[model samples]
Target: MTEALSLVPTTDARVARAIDLIWREADLLDRREYRAWDELYADDALYVIPIDRETDDFASVLNMVYDDTRMRRMRINRLTEGYAIAAVDAARTVRTVSRFVPLAVSDDEVTVRSAQILVAYKRDHHDLWAADVEHVVRLGADGDRIVRKVIRLVDSEAAVPAAGFLL
Candidate 1:
């Protein structure tokens, strides 16, 4: 069995909280609520899509996308401010995240693994992007915030189409 699906889902309160946040994030993305999506992350969060499937040292390795706070802000700006390009040409994406596997859970934090199938529609074509997603959530007293998100696309080494929406 694959590591991601080896473990079963849990009913822990912390896990529920983390999964709720993740689902909310997914809803925000589908609704094109970029600002709300931005608020879901912590200040020290890392958003990464690595080309190397096995390496976790994203800082030292090459990545398709590695966004810190500043970079993420800039990218969001490009998409939300520049023009209606993102609205017009950007693919309409609807993503399903399931098969929850709690990697680590604690009172202060939770790291979960899940499967994400994102369907993007552009013009007359519909494309599917399947990935294994790992989310590290910091459970704060006020609310939980995403500390790190790593999306590993199944076709990372193949020629992938342009994604008009954020994964």
Candidate 2:
């Protein structure tokens, strides 16, 4: 996928802000800003890592290790608390976002679908993962900011070691 931008039937300001937010997230993740990254999420948003079978439902498999806002915060805190080894010696990572297509836009909710490629280097080893992530952001009722943002990783059953770093 390519980082191509298209004009949809969305408010120019909102679309611009969304793209800016995504880019900021990319920068933060690359810089290992765990706390700042955590703060970007909504208070009650959900992070779902589904099994690789092409299903979004997480009721049975329960593929989410960090599903709720509180859990996500704990994950960030754990990273900073020096409990997770990957956090202590974090991997050098970068995420390239592409094909940012706006699927739907209600009054205060917008859905962005994009493909991302994340590369990480750890201890002279490199790992690259590519997947499409759906970002559901609920713009505040006052049209000021994002109220809720949901992230669902496409490859949640890849048997990877630990997902200590954000994509």
Candidate 3:
């Protein structure tokens, strides 16, 4: 039998903070707290859920979701308006966010990569979504905020359910 892995002590305070922020974000999304989730982003944040695994150029390729700050605000408005068809039958999500590895860390920015498993339940249907999420968090004068979030879905090329809320 394999031995249980022991938790290693993390040395960097920034990394700890980033992990906390990521977990809080995931919790907010799971709770459908969109307004609070939106506050975690920087003014010019870019959120992308790419359709193609090989392409990072959102402008040139078709993406599942690509939203700049204004577009993100519109999305939040649409979700909160109660008129969006996708939101009408929105699924409740339970997200498992783990393996938060800090790729890069600095005083001004922190780049982290993590794995996410989202289980969504609506009506009688349940869907499982998995992805590798990359977050570029910028350290603002006031606090840390996400500047970019790229969600590379493992089965992005396959057909998936409508994502009405933040992921």
lDDT of 3 by residue, 22-139 (tens): 8899999999888999999998889999999888788898898899999999988998889998886688999999887777777677788889999999888898999999998887
Can you rank all candidates by TM-score, best first? 1, 3, 2
lDDT of 1 by residue, 86-164 (tens): 6546888899999888998777888899999999988899899999999999999888999899999998878888665
Measured on C-alpha atoms, candidate 2 has an lDDT of: 0.67
Better lDDT candidate (2, 3): 3
Cα error of candidate 3 at position 52, Å: 1.4
Q: Deviation in angstroms for 23 in model 1? A: 0.4
lDDT of 2 by residue, 3-50 (tens): 233546334555556766777878987898878887667776777655
**Per-model CA lDDT versus the true structure:** 0.86, 0.67, 0.84
Clashing residue pairs in candidate 3 are: none
The per-candidate count of clashes, in order, stands at 0, 0, 0
- Name the regions of candidate 2 deviating beyond 4 angstroms: 1-11, 141-155
**Which consecutive 10 residues in model 2 have the weakest lDDT in total?**
1-10
Clashing pairs in 2: none
Looking at candidate 3, what is the lDDT of residue 20? 78
All models, RMSD in angstroms: 3.5, 4.8, 5.7
Q: Model 1 clash pairs?
A: none
